[model samples]
Target: MILLPTINRSVLLVIPKQPFYDWSNKLFPDLEPTNMADIDEYNSYLLEDELFIDDPKGELKSYWKKIFLNELYEQCMDETTFPALSWKLFTQWFDFHRSAVVSDLTSDPLYTDE
Candidate 1:
């Protein structure tokens, strides 16, 4: 699992181990997801990019754009392999991130009970 720390919270990218190379290519084509240390380094690069500029305002749309690309979706839809499992895992991961964003928004100081 790769832990991606965003502006508001951390996201865990759970890539299946059986097809490690295949999933690695699909999820992280530019870098390798070897361990937490590597993923942490990669996360630094992501945080520095312009896509994360609006992260503090509760806008993390870029993450979804990066994760749910057409090619990745098609790869997950391959019928001869673990299509259902892949789809399920992707959705679960996405749901967790989405929930985290919502939680962050709701718990912000503007809406806090303090």
Candidate 2:
């Protein structure tokens, strides 16, 4: 059997909170609103391996804008409809789970379209 592949990146899993759904609903009233418990899926971003080596919170803060905008874009394509975002609102809108170590369990080779 082939050995497991090595992945040097860390991971950040972002799960939307109630306020996110509230914002989405406000933008598109016709669409169904979602809740934290009802949502089973989330996005995981692979970050630098040294993310937590020093000043982890600061590192995370730097990446928040990109991550936050990605989450909003997934919910609604219309950028104009999204609310003005701040660091405080970003933290309030989602729950984040960070892992310094990421394991690649698959034996198959990994590919990226990019």
The top-ranked prediction according to lDDT is: 2
lDDT scores in order: 0.38, 0.83
**lDDT of candidate 1 over 7-85, digit per residue (tens):** 5444433332334335635555676544422332111112222333335224444444454443245444553443333
Model 1: clashing residue pairs? none
Cα misplacement distance, residue 93 of candidate 2 (Å):
0.4
Cα deviation at 33, candidate 2, in Å, is 1.8
Clashes of each: 0, 0
Estimate TM-scores for all models: 0.22, 0.85
Model 2, 15-46: lDDT tens per residue? 88999988887887877767677889889998
Q: Where in model 1 is the C-alpha error above 4 Å?
A: 1-22, 25-33, 41-66, 70-86, 91-95, 99-114
**Which candidate's TM-score is highest?**
2
